[model samples]
Target chain A: MDSIEHQDHPDRELLEMLQEAEAKVEQLRVELDRRREFRRQMRADEAHEGTDEEVERLSEYLEQAQINWQAVRKFFQSAIEEYRADDAWGSGRPGA
Target chain B: MSQTIRDESTDSEHGVRQIEVDGADTAAPASPLRRLPLTGRPLRIVEWLAVVAAIYVMITAVGAIGSGFEAATGGQAEELFSFASNPFVALVIGILATALTQSSSTTTSIVVGMVAGGLPIEIAIPMLMGANVGTTMTSTLVSLGAASDREQFRRAFSAASVHDMFNLLAVAILLPIELIFGVLGTIADWFAQLTTGTDGGIVTTIFTAFGDAVSAVTSPGADLIEAAVMGILPEVIGGVLMILLGIALILLIIKFIANMLKSLLVGRAERIFHAAIGRGPISGIGSGALITVMVQSSSTTTSLTVPMAASGKFSLWQIYPFTVGANIGTTMTAMIAAFGFSGVEGTAAMTAAAVHLIYNLFSATIIFAVPFLRPLPVKGAKWLGDLGAKNKMYVLFWLGGLFIVLPAVLIGVSTWVF
Candidate 1:
């Protein structure tokens, strides 16, 4: 049944959908990285601006953002791992 | 059973879970935006408070001085003039007292009050000159703070001591001329006549009112305290307390006033001075006058330049003209004080103040305008500063000779010879 589902659909259409989804994810990841880099640059600029008070505030914001991003990244990675494990278990069922 | 449950939960059938995860990811970017703190609001409040407190403290301190004086002197304010009967003695006393106290304003105010109370202008004039000399002690003592650093101490000490040397020079040249020719007295009298006609005016009225108000508050309290202590302690203790209170009040008020003025106007004043100092003799004189008027004491105005000098921020040469300006500025106090007196005494007081002004103007013109005399104090101060740097004992000796021993010797000689 899995083979039929894989073969009945045109390979090109399936590949295109997967490629489109991956392209969107890659674009978003790049945007996120660009923004992170921009933020880092902004922090560096703020440091050179010679205002201790301003630099302190910017540093604190950067730290909180870093912590939130780490938690989100971990959440997504764990969810992906759980989905993969369930797919394997379902595929290996004795009835199949 | 657990595998089938997990598969069901992870399957595409759970569309709500995917939507929630997507929503959470989308919201992650907004958290960074929420983190900035508010700035400048608290600092603004603090600055305003400082200004208000400074003004209040200054007024209270001035009021306290007046009160202390009234309490201590009572109806015997006239007796204060007895000390100034001998001009030389008055001069020495002014110098000694100011040196000990380290404030010209205190010495000048006391002298002004005594003059208003009936001290001769001639006697008070010399005392004013002494006060000018006496005020130099503060910066000299300040220089001692830098003593551990040799070069810094030398620079600071010289910068500090130069004020003393200049005043001494002024006194040396002018005193004899005044004694013989009565030059200062004559000039002062002429100015006094020209301005107030017969002497006494608005200045006296205002000061009297202010002094009366101060005395009203402090006198009763002081009298009660003195009465309470009469049998318990020597009468001299009351007298001492009165004097101390006067000194303390004056010092505290002047400090508050200085702080207020500094906070309110120093930045602008400094800019004005910098511009003026660069503009040749006229500008230098103008800058010095403005600073003195603003600060209200030439000693305070002139001494302001000393630390800058010692720090190598500006040279002694640049500051010399400003010092001349300060000399003129200091005379304003006496001039104002003169207005508080009337008739011949007022004329005398005004004249004395005028003499101080004229003498300084004349001295600056003669000493500073001519390149030859300009370097004298600088050279003398440098020599003494070098001596001080080499042996810290010289610093002590300088203090003793200028402030204590010399004044004592002069007083002794005047007593014996006159």
Candidate 2:
């Protein structure tokens, strides 16, 4: 019985990574859009003017969304790098 | 830093992933009663029985406290509250009485009884308003129990104070208007007129009969205790002892009732709240009101939200309308007591009760219905909770100042100045 089920296949791994990254990116984008819309609505509602606490809360939310976006971007970039490396190896290792 | 990831629970079988369900985790041995299956039913039945017992004990305790107050004051509560001719004094009296007893239902019910017994409606009205303010203190005190953990305290305190802030804000807006315009009084008078006909009314008949029955059962014990205490101690001290006993009984009984009810209904409460969230604020308020009416305690209903809020299951906004509903629901006790009166006194009692109901209804409508005003209590409570989280002294100061020191000073000043 083999302990290791399979060897690393960068092409397959990169494909899965791309799917995960795509979902993360979508989620982050939705969250950022939601926060931005909420902040914009708050600004429109002049009744809550001068409430620094609300402002701080919205800022914290925006910061979180930005952090999520950065992580998603990083994941996408790594997925692209893995895909490129796999393509190069596949071309270089030809049957003689 | 590097981290290793593992998915050991998943296994490859025939090139397909297989996941384990662990059926053993869900199975439990059954009892010998195969013909009848009872799961969690017996425990729930016992909890509900305890809940009823706790409520009866609480009612008896409130009766004891009211009787003690009357006995201790030598029926001088009217004289003590005479300075309440100044609405603020009466309001302060209401706050102190409810804070001391820790039940607005008790305080407002007492006010209703007093009004029936010939206490002026004007004085009783302010006291009733004070009860609304004072009752919030119980949940606020309950929230303080979470103070060891700053974050928990912050969330719980905010959840608790939202109720306090709403009531205080309501009083701020309504009390002056009440004093000048007499709008609540007029509305209550109309309600009283509408209900005064038809053989003392169904609500009144039920409440009066309930009140008499409760008194009959509890008064002898209270009187016996009163007589015994007076035999050893001074008359005033004996009265004071009764008051202290009543307060202790109320706190203990309410605590037990809340725990029992929570045990029995938490899952149901969570479901109700979840459903309320989907249905919007009206449904949330209705659930809050309904629960409070069932349990006969707004403090219990509101306090239940603290742990939920602290655990992040609910937000301040979601619980805000529910707490408002608690305010509306709590009026039922006072309203029920009002019906115990007959003739002019009955009219006065019902009037006072109507004032309580109208006050909560008007406050909820005016504050929550107006988009501009809706968020003030929530915002105010959040700020206070944030401040208190940073420094706990603020919590102590709020409890002491609003419930104790301030009420004491106002009452003293009113007595001296008025």
lDDT against the true structure, each candidate: 0.57, 0.66
Relative to the true structure, candidate 1 has a C-alpha RMSD (angstroms) of 29.7
For all predicted structures, in order, the TM-scores are 0.58, 0.60
- Roughly what TM-score does model 1 have, to 2 decimal places? 0.58
True contacts kept of each: 0.00, 0.00
* Complex DockQ per candidate: 0.01, 0.01
Worst 10 residues of 2 chain B by lDDT: B20-29
lDDT of 1 by residue, B1-418 (tens): 0011111011112211111121121111121112223113243244346544543333333333333444456536447657656667888988888877666766776565444434566776788788878888766765665544667767777877777878888888777777788777777667666664533567555544553454454445444544554546554455446445645755665555443443334434544653554456677677877877665666566656555555554556566667767777766655544444444444444555666678778777767666767788889888998886655556767877987788888888877877
- TM-score (second chain) of model 2: 0.71
lDDT of 2 at B134: 89
For candidate 2, the lDDT comes to 0.66
